[model samples]
Target: MTMANASNPFRGIRIGSASGAGLAGWQAETGRSPAVVHKHPVTYRCPLGHETTPVFADLAEEEIPEYWDCPRCGRAGSRRPGTQPGAVGPELYKSHLDYAKERRSPAEAEQVLAWALGQLRRSRGEEPAG
Candidate 1:
């Protein structure tokens, strides 16, 4: 095979070239820039029958966005009126008690509580009353 036909192995490659000369003045930042961001949920609806709630993070001094492009249809989506931003879903919360109620019957839970109280009483060297 001819020398020209033989691959140089380094073809189309430049080593140690400073192509990023424009960013010479840029400094590496330690820690976080724009630290402490707040989030808001904004809803976007497309004409193509697609809807989404996009949560956007806003910097401490920046304002939350009111609109976003629909990801499915690539159409402009405006924020719904009176809708709050950052997290989507009902605000109703379930505590540990609520979860326990869902997983156990009332009578079973009462039995478990009674057993726990008896164990505690025995550990403390006291007789548990019936």
Candidate 2:
């Protein structure tokens, strides 16, 4: 049935009226909404040029993180360079070889590779490649 045709049981009821007094008592006591808390916006930029600004609580600057995950590109982002104190430049990527070189000399690496290759060749019953 259409609402216009349906008869409301309390059609004439008003706020604070005897019929709606219970509803009125429980209704929001104030017409205005609660006050909004303070917020701080921080922008982060990824290497791919994606930028995202997220809101944080208006608190100490140190409380904010230095890096955040980019919502658009799924990469780690840092604050814009030279914008804030203690900002750091993007770290240079290091490969496994780079780290291994740091720990061992070229001669040692060659020796290890030769030993490993020898073991593999022996397991396969084949001569080791020079």
Candidate 3:
């Protein structure tokens, strides 16, 4: 044995290798042309006026949502309808009261609550509270 093999057990041995020489790997990976996936750009602007455009695969258009999170400010962004992302226009703004109105009218909620309380009282076999 040579002096070099004396220092290390694995020095003279290769544990494993590909079927062929190094060139085989290059041939297997880049031997032919590869196709690129298509992408579409979607733009959004947050209420704070931060704009960001993110690219999505063309296949994902159906799954893309109107709002996206801003990469910088972390706010949800809105997409402008009927125009490309660069266009600026009025955006609908909603307040807490607006959202609440959509959920329930004051009288409607009171009726639902009363009905729920009556059900609970009947379940317990107790007199319904006024």
The candidate scoring highest on lDDT is 2
Question: What order do you get sorting by lDDT, best first?
Answer: 2, 3, 1
- The estimated TM-scores of all candidates read 0.37, 0.44, 0.37
Alpha carbon lDDT at 113, candidate 1:
96
CA deviation > 4 Å runs, candidate 3: 1-30, 81-130
Model 2, runs deviating above 4 Å: 1-43, 48-58, 67-76, 81-93
Question: In model 1, which regions exceed 4 Å deviation?
Answer: 1-91
Task: Rank the models by TM-score, top first.
Answer: 2, 3, 1
Worst 10 residues of 1 by lDDT: 22-31
Residues 7-107 of candidate 2 have per-residue lDDT tens digits of 76545434444323333322335533344569999999876788899999897988998877667765567786534223264344466787899999999
- Per-residue alpha-carbon lDDT of candidate 3 for residues 77-98, written as tens digits (9 for 90 to 100): 7786333223343334566777
Q: What is the lDDT of residue 55 in candidate 1?
A: 70
Top candidate, metric TM-score: 2
> What do the candidate models score in CA lDDT, each in turn?
0.58, 0.69, 0.67
